[model samples]
Target: MKTAYTAALSMLAGIAVGAVAIEGLHAQSTPKAYVVSEIEVIDQGAQNAYLPKVTELIKSSGGTFLARGGNIFAVEGEAPKRVTIAVYDSFAKAQAARTSPEWKALAPERNKAIKVRSFITEGLPN
Candidate 1:
């Protein structure tokens, strides 16, 4: 009876340790989300007017800019005039930022001035 009880406790302890290890691994493996925008300035005047407001809105929504208005070279496909990359805490946050009231209010201005192709992608684990 003693041996049986000890064996059961050992098994439970092993399972607990294994569970913790798996959870830790999962946390480490979680990926971040990136919001990428490819923009073409159809009307430079209008785009210049609209950019500052939207840039502030994005910053308020927990977004960090990785790249903005830099040189882009196309390896295979066509490249847009400007490429913007922003990282959010998660996919949900990225979605929320796009749909936020402040961002929505500026949509008309952006649409009038620039052509934008934007998407969210899962980034590799750190």
Candidate 2:
């Protein structure tokens, strides 16, 4: 009878451990995706400083630059252009990250030195 009780107790402990592990995994926060577009201003020489600053901003936001220098392959009847594409975890995460100390330092250069457009995009479902 004692041996049976010991085995039953072991089984219950194992089940409890498994439940805790599963719940912990589910509780973990998952990151999403954010897309950013940067358009170079007409005065190219003065705008060079912002590129590196924006780079630091992305890194501070729990992400990194996906594409720094994008080329204009075939404009299909559009003017030649230089562009950059960036991706971050999620919309909300990216928004929150924008207010980070690192981003705040980078923000001024973005507003005056260059023109940037950004939006959050839902990445592929997991």
Candidate 3:
């Protein structure tokens, strides 16, 4: 009887551990948010001035740049003058970063520098 009881307890403990591990794995697999910005610089001088400020704002908002305007070979369609991709913790955060007061404040300056088409999409779990 005692041996049977011990085995049952061991099984329960194993099940509990497995449940916790699964929960942790699920949490880690939560999808992130990605922001893609396609920009066409109208004024090089203005764009140069706006770059650093916008870059700093993005970094401060928990965003990590996956790509920021470098050499590109278009596989199909023509590419924009510049492309920037950033990943945020979640969709809400990504949207918030784009619509935040700090970002809105820069609209006048950013508009003067470049024309941008930006969107946010959810990323796949890794």
Winning candidate number (TM-score): 3
Pick out the ten consecutive residues of candidate 1 with the lowest summed lDDT. 24-33
User: Candidate 2 — which residues are off by over 4 angstroms?
Assistant: 1-31, 73-80, 99-105
Q: For model 3, how does the per-residue alpha-carbon lDDT over 21-52 read when each residue is reduced to its tens digit? A: 99888767878999999999999999889999
Greater-TM-score candidate between 2 and 3: 3
Residue-pair clash count for candidate 3: 0
Q: Candidate 2, residues 1-126: lDDT per residue as tens digits?
A: 999999999999999999999976654544456565646575565577766666666776666667656566764765335555556656566767766677777666667776666565656634
Give the Cα RMSD of candidate 3: 4.9
Candidate 1 lDDT by residue in tens digits, 4-110 = 99999999999999999998887667777899999999998998899888888889998999999988999988978999999987787899999888888888899
Quick one: best lDDT, which candidate?
3
Which ranges in model 1 have alpha carbons more than 4 Å from their true place?
Answer: 1-30
Per-prediction TM-score:
0.74, 0.61, 0.76
What C-alpha RMSD separates each model from the true structure? 5.7, 4.8, 4.9
Give me candidate 1's TM-score against the actual structure.
0.74
